[model samples]
Target chain A: MRDFDLLQPQHLSDALDALAQNDSAIRPLAGGTDMLVDIRAQRAKPDVLVSLQNISELRGITRENGTLKIGAATTIAEFLKHPELTKHDALRYAAYVFANPMIRNSATIGGNIGSASPAGDMLPPLLALDAHIELVSKNEARVMPLSDFFLGPRKTAKRANELITSIQLPVISYQSPVSSLQSPVSSAFYKLGLRQADAISLISVAVWIQRDGEKIRDVRIALGAVAPRPMRAIRAEEILRGEIFNEMNLKESARIASEECSPIDDLRASANYRRRMIAVYVRRMLEQAWSKTQ
Target chain B: MQKKTILFSLNGEPREWSVYPNELLLNVLREQEFLTGTKYGCGIGECGACTVHINGEPILSCLTLAIACEGKEILTIEGLAREGKLDPVQIAFLDQTAFQCGFCTPDMILMTRALLNEIPNPTEEQVRDYLRGNLCRCTGYASIMRAALDASVLNAHRSVQSNEE
Candidate 1:
């Protein structure tokens, strides 16, 4: 690996200053699981390395005003341990199947999202949850929906001077148990990997739904590993939303979602196999989520 | 390229090295520190052959930068045995013959150490989850799994005996 100056910033503001000064020449090191791999493989060669380990503010999970704020440096293991996060089935399940215990101990959700892999385990769940990223720079800061944060594979909407501070997810409230007649919000996530652990996704699906009696009031279906970016199957969601989630409708939505993706034949799986698995996984996720609402 | 004095505790001993920022912890421990227990397998984070404890958590040393570990406490396979006493995990592996080629032994032991530290009595599924990254080509993991369970029991037994004394 080529040598670079490691910059250990004492303050978050100092870190932002260094990033702003060096621009693209500096890479923020979080977890070091992904960054170190890229550096060793000659895929990334940043002249200066900015270590964020000392930035205490970017390292915990918090909730306020019905919004969940997870620091960008929070590890996957930390995400799994949060009591409130575990209650959200989609988020909990994604964390459960993300890599293994070793990787999760160091792999941060921010790094996972920043790497912008279309097959990122957190992307599907974050997309389904309607999460937003808080990006801060030396001069200013801004927040954007997580769905719009990814431009393509390994590409993000973040500018060179900006550092992702936190991921904000609005807590979805379920119908009160006292109102037994009202429908409740439910979600589910499923990933199809080559092996049980540490394998990247062949295809993955997540669904967030709220039902009114037998009809789906609102729904969002996110698919990964079958596209250049983790994306919502908007047309499929449109078809399923406000419609009775019967066998025929659910099957049709799944078929549409599968057909909408543009996947290539990769080393892990074939494009055709990915499409089929996407359909199957999406159907299963939708069924599971629908059942949970009942 | 820049170099700095990397100071950290290695196996409970203070160690320092003047090295490049890009130097991997696995290489530094094996080459500079002359601690070769942690083997380099995949060079990437895919394999846990170079797994070590950073302040108590198991991470791939090959994927970790030496300079970034300035203040962290590192625990490798060499640290498992202290004052001529073998760790229960080491004894269990010896008794069960957990390894054949023994290439991935240190990694497995260190991973098991971290696992049993976290979950004193873990289920079979938990053991599988914890050691999934550490691959063993010779033993095929059956004996290793058995040894890990035995290690848990032995550790608990040792703790009880010490407490009684």
Candidate 2:
């Protein structure tokens, strides 16, 4: 690694002040699972490194005000271990999507969201759960819905001085003891990769739904690696909302969702393969989620 | 260079040291502590060859900064045994011949330890998923699975025996 000035601020205020002092030349550090890799690979080099390790507000998981507020620096392990997320629909789904134990224990959901990789495993779930991000700076702080946070692949609405503070996810605590989803909604996250582990997705989908009798009440569908950023299948979801559960309709919706993706042909997979796989995943996820509702 | 003094617990001991802001925690373990069990396969986070348990959860040491772990409990493969006694998992691995080339052995063992810590008795599918992070180019993980399950059974037997006694 190239020599760089490292600054560790004992408090959030100090961290922000350092960021304010070196606004353009500073890059804040989180879990560094992603950032360190980028730096070592020569992707990014800032003159000042503001380590967020000592920032107290950037850690922990809490359930308050009917929302699960997860600190930005909270590791994926923290999110998975969070008592509330496992109960909700999308978050529970996202919690199980990532399989690598090391990544789960170290990679922060904020860094994942901040990195804005189209293949970010948590984005789909956060988008589905209607989560919002708190981006804080020395002078100001702003909140953005997870959906609007992403600009494109590897891009976000984050300013130079801004640092993500926490992600607040609205908890879906509604439970029907006499219903199929009594045991936290059954979720299926399918990411097609060359190997079962350590392989980035060629295409991935996260689907979460609430079943009302024979009809689906709230259906969320998000796909990654098939678009520039993790994107919601809005039209597809719209098609399923308030619609009676049917395999045929689900398959058709899958096709429509596949049609929406602008996948690129790369060495990992062909664009055609990704689109077709997206359809397959939509079908698989719906079938799995629908079966759980049953 | 970005250098700072850090205080952290290592293998159940507390100490302080100076580390580069950019230095990976794995490097500190290898260079400072001389704990060579934590191997480095990939500098990036793609490979799980440099995984360690930070505060009871398996994390990639290579991706972790030395300064970030100032006050966290870390468990490397070296800390598995107590007072020279092999941990049940280690015994099971040795008994079942879990490794071949052994490059991935330490990571696999630590990963298994972490998995068993959470899921004491994991099914084959769960084991596969839980051990998904660590890679083994040799042996295809057949014996590794056997060893992990065998260790669980052994631990269960010991627990039951202790209760009975």
Candidate 3:
């Protein structure tokens, strides 16, 4: 760690003001987990570090009108404990399996989103749930859908002067009595890694299904770590909507899902292996999602 | 970089200090307070050696900025014992032979304490899930799990005896 100017803003306004002042060289740090790792690797060298830890407003979990708002500075550890998120069983399970306890406690939703890595553990769940993000600057604030947030791997629509305030997620009602085949939503997200606990996903998928009896409704599937960004398999999703929910439908969906991805094989796995895993995960996750409704 | 002075309670006593802008809580503990009990085996967050209780939650000190300590209470491994008496988790670790090289003991003890705090009577699998972050290099995890279970049993026994009286 080189000698750097640390700015600990006591309030949200102050933090944004500081960012405005040091717009060129300042990087907002909610938790040093990602920033420090990047700094040590010499990948990032910000002359001024904008520390958001002291900004109390940035740490909380709240819900209003069936919308869940998670503060950007809130740690993943904190996110895992939120009763609202836990109620969303699939998202909570993904959060639990993300990384070690230490990383969870020290890493932030903002940082994870900031990294914009295709392998970001929380993004798929948020994307599948149709989450919205709020970004702030010294003089302005804007909210955008998660789909519009990412530009590429490690890139986003955010300007240098801006900072993420919180992420808001629309809550889905799962308590209503509905037939498994006719439920409004049947969805699941799966990540395949080398082992289980902490390894990065070689491939992953997020599938949300709408059902009308044995006939499928609008279906959305998102895959991650296979492209520059986590991508919605729109073609595959198109292939499934209004289709019959059966083994044949699942097989067709899986094939479309595999071919829809633009995965490149690195040392972690080969492109061919990723395509196969994508198909396997698509079927497995979709079945599990349907089973939950049943 | 600019600097700030923070005052917070450490263990049971209040302490005030100033830290450099880039100083992490782990470095401050190791260098300033001379609390080597909190090991810094991995600068990265993967290892649990730098684990500490930040306001009762286990957070990696290495990844936490020292400036964040402005008003929060911190409990390191040294704070576990009170009045020179070993905490039950600490005693259980030794009784169940939970360490080989003794390097990961502090982190293991603290994590076990945190786990028991949340789930007073944790099952084997629950214990393992929480301990996934705390890796013991000497491969002393079997006894560590045994020790956590033993601590739970000891608490049950103590409660039963007290109830009988």
Model 2, which residues run further than 4 Å from truth?
Answer: A21-24, A63-66, A172-188, A210-213, B157-165
DockQ-based ranking: 1, 3, 2
Candidate 2: chain B TM-score against the reference chain B: 0.93
Tens digit of per-residue lDDT, candidate 3, span B1-165: 566788998887899989877888999999999999999987878788999998898988888778778888999999999889777788888899899999999999999888888888999998888888887889888999999888777666656776999
Candidate 1's residue-wise lDDT over B1-165, tens digit each? 768897889889998889888899999999987889999999878888999999999988888888888888999999889999999999999999999989899999998989999999999999998898888888559999999999999999989998999
Tell me the lDDT of model 2 at A32: 77
Deviation (Å) of A173 in candidate 3:
5.6
- For model 3, residues A59-133, the per-residue Cα lDDT tens digits are 788888888898998888775788866755557767787787768877888888988999888888778778899
- 2 against 3, candidate with superior lDDT: 3
- The residue ranges of model 1 lying beyond 4 angstroms of the native Cα positions read A175-183
- For all predictions, the C-alpha RMSD in Å is 1.8, 2.9, 2.5
Ranking by lDDT: 1, 3, 2
Which candidate number maximizes DockQ? 1
The fnat of each candidate, in order, is: 0.78, 0.88, 0.78
Q: Give Cα-based local distance difference scores for all models.
A: 0.89, 0.81, 0.83
Q: Return the DockQ of model 1.
A: 0.76
Look at candidate 3 and tell me the lDDT of residue B84: 97
Return the TM-score for each candidate structure. 0.96, 0.90, 0.93
Instruction: Please give, for residues B1-165, the per-residue lDDT of candidate 2 as tens digits.
Output: 746787878888887989876778899999989999999898887668898888888888988878778788988999889789788889999999898888888888888888888988999888888887777887558999899889888777767876999
lDDT of 3: 0.83
